[model samples]
Each structure stands twice: as C-alpha cells, then as structure tokens.
Target chain A: MPSETPAAYDPSAYPPFAVTVDLVVLTIRAGALRVLLVRRATEPFAGRLALPGGFVQIDEDLLPAARRELAEETGVRLGRAHLEQLGTYGHPDRDPRMRVVSVAYLALVPDLAQPVAGTDAAEADLVPVAAVEPLDRLAFDHGRILADGLERARAKLTYTTLATTFCPPEFTVTELRAVYEAVWGTTVDPRNFHRKVLASDGFVEPTGETTTRGGGRPAQLHRQGSAEQLHPPLTR
Target chain B: MPSETPAAYDPSAYPPFAVTVDLVVLTIRAGALRVLLVRRATEPFAGRLALPGGFVQIDEDLLPAARRELAEETGVRLGRAHLEQLGTYGHPDRDPRMRVVSVAYLALVPDLAQPVAGTDAAEADLVPVAAVEPLDRLAFDHGRILADGLERARAKLTYTTLATTFCPPEFTVTELRAVYEAVWGTTVDPRNFHRKVLASDGFVEPTGETTTRGGGRPAQLHRQGSAEQLHPPLTR
Candidate 1:
C-alpha cells in the first residue's frame, strides 16, 4: 500500500528527553509525621537522599505514572492510598544532563505497608518529617515540591474528607484523631474533636461496629460518608 | 583555573537543563470568571491556545518568572496580584520537541489593567473560565493544570487574606463582597460578610478613609493587615 501522509518529523529529530514521576508520600507514624523517601543507587547524586521516583512509560496518564512509580519503588498498589497530582517540576537545569521533566504526586497512605524496595532504589525508608530540616540538599527541586505538598496535605485535612483516606476502610475515632494531631502538629482536645466529627455531616458514619485496636475501651468504627465537599468546612 | 579533582563521570556532566514558568492569570469579568490566554506563534502546536509563559531566567525566582512572563506578554505589572505557586508540570511528551518542564503559578489580579498582545502571541484574549472547557484540545495537559489552579484559588479565598488581592488597595465592603461572590460563584449575605471581616483579626484595618470611586454614599476604606496565617480559617 502507498505510504500514508508523511509524519511531520521522526521522534529522533529532537534531543532525547526523559520523563519521570515522583511521589511525595506522607503519613503519620508513631505520633510523628513522616514522608517516604529513598536513597539513590545510580548516578546523578547516587547515595543522596531523594523522594521515591522513576521513569514514566509511553502509555499512561500522569497519575498513573505516579502510581506506577510508587508501585515499582515500594511494591504498593495504586489503590489502598489517597493520591492526587501535586504539581509538575520541569526546569531545564533541574537535571544536570539531558532535559527531564517530572510529574509529581502527593500520596497519603493511612498505615504504611512494608516497603519492597525496587531494583532502581538503593534503599527506601520512612523518614520522620522533623528529621528533614536541611532540605536544601534534597535531590532535584523536590525539597520545595515536598514542602508545598506537605502544606497542602495539612490544609486539606482541615476542610475535606481527604484525611480519611489515610486510614483503613473502617477505623476508630481515636485513630482518626491521631491523623489530625499528626498533620496539624497541634494537640486537639479529644472531647472537642469527637464533638466536631459527629457534628460535621457526612464526615463519618457509624459502621454499626466497634474496634479494640488499642487496649482501651473499644471505640466506634466509622466509614467515609457520601459527602464529597465539606460544607461549613472544618477550621482550626 | 587550576585543575580540580576529576569529578569522575558525574551525572551533573549533562548540559544545564532549561526551566520555564507559566502563569494562569485569572480575573472575574462579566459576572463570570475569565482566564488570560495566548496563542503560540511557533511549533509545537503553533497557533494553538495556551497559557502565557516563558523560560525562567538564571537570576530570577519562580514568582519573578511568573511576573516577568505576565509583563512581557501583556505589558502589565502582575506584581500587585495574589500570586501563588500552583505546582509544577513536567510530562516528557508535554513538549514534543525537547525536554521542557514548566512551573505553573496561579495569579489573581483585580480588574485593573487591559492586556496588550505580545509578539510571540499571535492572538491574546481573556476567555471566560466556564466557556473554555478542558476537552482534550488545550494544547497540552494545561487543561488539567488550569482546573487544579482554579480550585486552589477558590478554596484559598475561604481561609486566607487572599480575596483582597482581587480588590483595589482602597475598596469598600460591598466591593469586597463582590470579589468573594465572583470567585466562589455563590451569593453571600453582605451583613454576615461585614461582621465576619471585622471579627477576623488582622483581616483588614480601617484607614479612617472612604472611597468615592463609585457614585453612591461614601464607602469606608480599609487596608490589608499583617496576618501571616489565619488561626481559625474563614468558611463559607
């Protein structure tokens, strides 16, 4: 058959461009806020600390790319977590060699699962948020991106049902309280927190069950409600 | 200079990558929100509609890059607007030719100045936010970026000292009400708004002045205060 209309230009016409997806995974662990990070094994700041990231394939949406990176690096499913597009970082100089643009995602996993480090990662670990002080040395411009994502996570917990994403399908109110306390970095009165949660419509509905996750009195188990947007949004 | 340590095969050996900052300039016009858009005059997607943007110069920060882009394309200082980093977007195929990445900023400017089209921009216009639906034809993944930016802007106004950024330095309470109405696309009780503004500490301070910009009873003038973060965030 005759060749179809000539393609404008072959893919080889331009310089080799690398696309990647980075994940700023955050969670509450042991009464402190933590972020998921990995040590780089390959060149380009090998051995330096960095966020979980990897190359994006040719056929996937940006979120899918992030989920793929997460799965590849940590052996986690794209589901069982709260994920959203944080933003993108594409500075020509961001990468030293060729041009690389990264689509970053902000992920909140309720209770972290054991990380199954990918072959590409030198080592993966959960880092306490407080320990990342001198973030200036973080790989890429991710230091800034991480900060933005963290702020968004903190603020979102106050107004949306997003915080619930950080917990299992059915969780105790006390567990939910911890998520708030960890994110806000402030101690909330348990009595007040309890009242507010029940007052906010569609925030949490009783699952007709109770949980003894802790050794104290069994707490009521609740699930996320139908409300998508929180009305009269919760504030500090 | 003298020969230093041979930094053996550093990945940093690659050429300095290029970074760009794109701005999604938004304003409320004609009772509906509008966004500033420019048509590219050169390939990749020449003559296609896209947000106004440009490469970030070596000496500039992200905010400055956004402002410079605005001034270069529209011939207006976007300094007074409420400018915030929306996030970064760097999908490899986002730019067909090279590995180009963009840092996107969301800017809200009070309807103060008219835009003058630029040389690179074949056509410039303010398109209503509702009219420009993200139907897979917005040049790149810019439609997704715009949606995220708009949501951030709308949510921010409810809890920060941001809505005032969309109003002149000396605006009336009623004028302030309009800013919220336009941004949130909802009606607010004027009396409730006035009372709430007075209640929020450092929200606004009386200038002992009044404005005569409109033909009506003199409206009181107030200046923005120095509240970095709102403790009890405002809710609609």
Candidate 2:
C-alpha cells in the first residue's frame, strides 16, 4: 500500500507515471483557424495525425517542456508564439502502454512559414480547425485536448486580449476583427465591433501609424494594450 | 538519448514520476471566504497548514483521486461540492524527495459541519482567505496553489454563475449578494445589486417561496438559472 503518513509519504512506493506535454499551436491562416498537427511515424498509431508533443524531461518545467516539444516536432521557436497551460488529462486508461499524464498547452502564433517535421513527427501540417474530425483522425486523447484548447481560445477571445496574439505586432483593426471572424466562423458587424473594441478599456491603442495592406484606404494601426481582461467581456 | 522516432516512443526508458491530487476547497463562513487546510502530520513540512491532498492511485482517475483525498482528509462527500480541474504543478525542485506532478482541483461547497482530520492530517480547519500567508505558511508549493485557486474563484464570480455554488439550493437574493460580498471582499450597493441581478438574463429565477431565517420579513427565494455565463458579467 502507498504510505499513509504524510511525513512518511514515499514516492517510490507508488507506481510511477510518465508525464508528457502536448501543444495545440493555433494560427489564423487563409481566413480560417488552423492547428499544428504531426503525422505519427511509429506504431501506437502509425501515420496518424496527432498534436505535436513529447515526454517531459527530468530537468525542465512544464512550460519549458511544452516549448521544447513544440520546437522539436514543428521547428517553431518559443519566442514567436504565445503559450499557456490549457489543462492536464490523466485518465487511468488514457494511454494503452501505461498510465500517462499529459499537461496540454495552447499556443497562438502569427502567420509564419509552413512547419517542417523534425525529430519524431513524420510530417507537420496546419490543419483547419473546421476540417479536423478529432474523434476519427487524431491519435490517443488528442481530439479531446484539441477541442478543449479551441474552446479555451474562443472563450479567451471574449474576455482577454488574446486575439491580438494572432495578429502582427502592428495591425489594423480590420485585421484584428478578421481574427474573431475566422475563429468564431461568424461575421460581426464592423461598426459594432469597432465601437465595442475601442470602448473596452485598454483592449487596444492606436500606434499612430496607418497601414494600407490589401486595402483601398489606409487604416489606423493599433497595438495590444496592458489590460489582461475586458471589463464588459465581448461574449459570443 | 531519448528516442527520436515517434513510433519508437517508450515510456519505461524515461524516468517515471509520481502523481498526486491536491484540493483547494473554498466556502463562505461568517461572511468570510475560507479555504479548507490540513496540518501536516509528518516530516516534510510537518506541523504546517497545507491544502488537503494525497497520491493518486494506479487505477483511479484524476477526479476520483481528488474526491477520495477530499473525503479521506476532511470527510466531505463528493456530491455536496462543485469541483473542477485547476491546473498541474510540476517544477523539478517543487518536491524535495522526487518529481511529483500534482493535479490541483478547485471545489466549492455549501455550509457543512467542521471537518475532522483523518489519517494524514493532524487537524483540519477552515482558514479565512485573507489570513493565508501562502508564501510562508503552507507546505510544498501549496501557497502558490491556494493563491491560484483563490484568484480563479474571484475571477469566476465575474463571468460565470459560480457564486451559486456557494449558496444553498434555495436562497434569497440577499444571501446570493452575501456570497459575492464574501468572495470579493467588498460591499455592493443593495439596490444596484438587486437591479443588476434581476436584469442579467438567466442569472436567477424565483422559486415562488420565501423564508424568515433571521426573524425579519420573509424574502423571496431564488435558485440558480440554466445560464452557464452571466452576460455583462458582474465585474468586481
């Protein structure tokens, strides 16, 4: 039996479980929300698409582990992405090989070059969120993890300045609005969205420059502000 | 070196880590937000107040492990509480003995009898949120976990209808307001609060009953509504 005394709690007496970190790296590409996926190269589910992830190292912290796994599999550096802990999944039977606990992370990155699979993944691709049949295509419990990450992203858009993470450092309000449109798959009235975005204290601030990217007229450029949360959350 | 091939991923090759579940159970007592804490009875930080927790069994799921730990440490049944996964803590130096990844959970329960300490804890007590010196008093990394749980609960009250979790099945608007007051640690104008609560769609609905709990005029009783979120959330 495992130790019953708190002071005498012996970790070695209990069965040890492997801890892994999984990344749900999301980006807005071609007017759609897409997630980074890797084709598994070996047997548990060979050739199957899965979220890029790997075992956490003994010397690293959770975030560092996530960053390492992401970089190793997808060749994406940590500095270019915004990552946060999504949740942990530890069902007794989540892994067939053994008891494995996964600390899932959610990441958002601006448009970048297509990912090149490195160490463990056979191939890396950005799959549209709408096209992912999580239950049918992904290996293990990745589908559930992906769904939770998407939900968290969607919810964060409502109350946090997270949407800005999907845009360039300097972007137009229209570009920012497009992010919500792509992720939510719904058109928001530009006038209303503009008013609401500006009204929410510290959501965004003018950068004093105008940009005319693929546009007929120059639009005011804005940057993310210091606020972490929106007072009157922009609910969907 | 660890396997670089995805198909060749082996769990046994890498070092295994022990997993545990910790609970940051919160409730309101005497109009103060309180958290359930146990005095460690053994050598690692013995005699310190820490969040009630224990090792996760091999066959049990994360939630079940948390439920079992809560019951064993405090005799609080799972059914009377609203529990959710908070986050996972796994810094390499977090535990002095070995790598122990803890899946922390946050629970909210209605009024209940004082908890009786079990096998591991020397004593269990409800500590007011304001009094917790998380950085200095708690064992392991519990102070950080407790702080995170408290922040989550405080933020949840702003957007989610989580305050209802702190009230009885049937309660008055005043009682509901008290839940907010205790959690937020601020006074809200009663008239404004009443108007806002009634205006927020699906926040609460009358149960068509009233009670004179403290010998004053009976106030209409209300219950939680079906809405998971409060539109135009109650900001602190």
Candidate 3:
C-alpha cells in the first residue's frame, strides 16, 4: 500500500507517464455513421488505423488539447463539433513505449469537411462505422474507444438535441430524422420521429423557413435549440 | 502543429505526467447526501480537505487502482459500491508539484462503513455535500471534480438503477425515495415516487419479504434488479 500522502512527496520521483489524447470523431455522411481515423506512420502499431490524436502539451488543458490535436493530427477543424471527454484508459501495457495514460474524447461533428493526412498520419479519412468491427481492425485499444463513443452517441440521441450537430446550420425535420437514423443505424418512422422531435421541448426551433431538399412537401427548416436534454426521450 | 506520426516517433521525449485517481465516494447518511474527504497530511494544502485519492502505480490498471486507493486512503471498502469513471481533469497547473492528470471515479456506496484516518490522510471523515458548496472550500481542483460527480449522481438517479447502490440489500420504497430526495435535494410526492419506482421495468424486485423498519403498516422489501437503465426514467 502506498501512502496517500508522503511526509514531503517528491514530485520528480513519481512514475514517468506520457499523457496523450485520442479522438473518436463521429458524423453521418451519406446515410451512414462514420468515424475519423488515421494511419499511424510510426512503429509499435505502424501502418495501422487508429484515432487521430497527439500528446497533450504540458501547458494545455484537456479540451483545448483535444481540439488542437484533432486539427493538427488530421487536418480537420472541429467547427462547432460537440466535443466531450469520453473516458480515460490506462492499462500500463496499453502502450508498449511507456506508461501512457490516454484521455479519449468524443467529437460529434456536422456532416461537413473531410480529413487529410497530417505529419503524424500516413493517411486520414472517415471510415463507415459499419466497416470497423470485431474490435481488432484498428491499432492498440482504439477500437474499444470508438465502440464506447458510438454507444454514447447512440444513447444520447434519445435524450439530447445532439442530432442537430450532424445536420447543417438549418435542416428539415426529415433531414434531422436522417441524422438519427444514420447514427442509430435504425430506421425511425418519419411521422413518429417528427412528432417526437416536435414534442420534445426546446429540441429544435423552427426557422420559419421552408426547404424543398427533403422532397414531397416543402419541409420546414429548424435549428438546434437551447435545451440540451429531451424529456420523454425518443427511444430507439 | 505536430505530426500525428513521425517516421520513428520518439516516445521517451514526451512530457512527463503524474496520473492519479480521485474518489468521490458518495453515500446517503442521516437523510442527506455526503462525500468522503480526507485532510491532506503533507504540504500542498496540508491539513485542508480534499477527495480521497492517490497515485496510480506503474503496473496497475485504472479501475483497480481506484478501488485500491479508496480502501487504502480512507480505510473504507467498496463492498458493493457502484464505482464508475466520472471524468478526467488535466489542467497544467492543477497540481503545483507537477503536471498531474487525475482520473476521477464516482462511487455510490451503501450506507455502511465510516471512514478512519489513514496513512496519507491526516484526518478522514464523511462530509455532507450540502456543506461543501461554492466549489472553493476544498484543496486543489477537487471542488470542481466533486461538482461533476454530484451532477452525474443526481442525473443518473433519474434514469438508472444506480440509486439502489445507496441502499442496503433489502429496503422499502420509502427508503429508496429518501435516497432520491437526499441526492436530488428535492422532495417528491411519496405516492408518485413509489408508483414511479415500481413502474420502472426491473428497477427493483420484491424479496418475498416485508420490513417494519420503515414504520407504517410494514412495507415490502425489494432488492436491485437486473435492469441497469430505466426506460421510462423516473423524473426528478
């Protein structure tokens, strides 16, 4: 058992740890859910796919570090992405290089912009989540992180207004419903989803504008609302 | 901008970090929400209150380290405490000694054990959460961590079976409602609360037993059920 407090704890003598940030950037592109990933150009997991991230600067805080790493590593700006801390992973052996503690972040970005390979990435692109499965397709424990992020994203859609993050600035209810469909990977009844979306207080606000993009009828445009939570959640 | 991948990335040159686990052991005591805190035995806010936690060992996994530290630092065992990662806090100057990244765990334990002074802690006690307000009463950035934990606990009670973790093996609906009132710091109509608790699918299962412990005409004793999430969540 280690002392909770040592008489005069020596900071320099503590275990050497390398702290890094890993992002699970998710979005809906072409009616399917996708995650941004990069090809590692370095060893240990060389030439394999992994989440785009980098070391957290000694002076930077966690959120800013995550946002910075996303841009620097993948050449992708968050741009209104709903970024949140997913979890932290420290398995001692998770990193063969040393004792590395990775703070994983989940970024839900709108369906816009693509990733380009950065200095640390050999190649960068959005891969359909459907294609990445069985937890071994990606390098290290990244697959697990992605799985957790996906789960959080899916569950949140039922009780949060986050689906709007996957839509454009103003979108039709049909388009909003598509975001749910894509992320949840399940078809939600249009009438039911529309009613539920409207019923959920502050889930969205009508822009008083109409769009023909949804086809059939001139659909009303709406934007994300102030409320973050959905009472009487839209269950999957 | 740093490269996501360097031809042969030098891991040893990365910034050093001290990773620690901070526990927010919350329990319902005397019909009030309480958290376990320890008085720092050494400098860096010595003798001031903070969450009970310690350094993560080189070869230890995070969850195990949290469980181990909780027991070691406060002389308190989890028993069946529902412990889960709350979030991670990494502010460059959070710990004056070094750049420390703390992985915080939220523990909802049954009201059973009390804390005693331990090695690193000069004094240990369960402090009422209501009394530890304003976010600046505690040492370090622990106050912020405690706030996050409390918010999570309050919200989870609305949609998860986690509230049972604060109760003994067999308890009446009244006792369970008290957990909610204490944690949420709001009073709910007892009839409505009882009805909602029993209605949440698999939230609790009858033990084929009754309890005069709650007074009144003997209430039914129930134990936690298999369901982790409440579909029709009990609203706060």
Candidate closest to the true structure, highest DockQ: 3
lDDT of 3 by residue, B147-226 (tens): 99998988888778889999988889999989988887788899988898898788899998997976679899999877
Candidate 3: residue A93 Cα off by (Å): 0.8
Clash list (residue pairs), candidate 3: A5-B120, A120-B3, A120-B4, A120-B5
lDDT of 2 by residue, A1-236 (tens): 11365455565677789898988989988999999887776767777788888888887899899888777766666655789999999998877777888999999988656545557527778889999874557888898999999999998887788788888788888899999999989998888888888888888889999978857888889987667665566636
Sort by TM-score, best first: what order? 3, 2, 1
Error of 2 at A36 (Å): 0.7
lDDT of 2 by residue, B85-181 (tens): 9999999988777888999999998766665566663777888888886456788888899889988988888777778878888888889899999
In the range A19-39, model 3's lDDT, one tens digit per residue, is 989999888889999988877
Give the per-residue lDDT of model 1 (tens digit) for A1-236: 00111256443433344556788888777878888877766656666778887665554446777877777666666556778878666566786644666777899886665754564626777888888857878887779878988988886786787777777788877888888888877777888788888888888889999878787888899987666565555546
Task: Compute the lDDT of residue B104 as modeled in candidate 3.
Answer: 97
* lDDT of candidate 3 at residue B233, scale 0 to 100: 67
DockQ of all candidate complexes:
0.15, 0.50, 0.52
Model 3's CAPRI class is medium
| DockQ computed for model 2 against the true two-chain complex using alpha carbons | 0.50
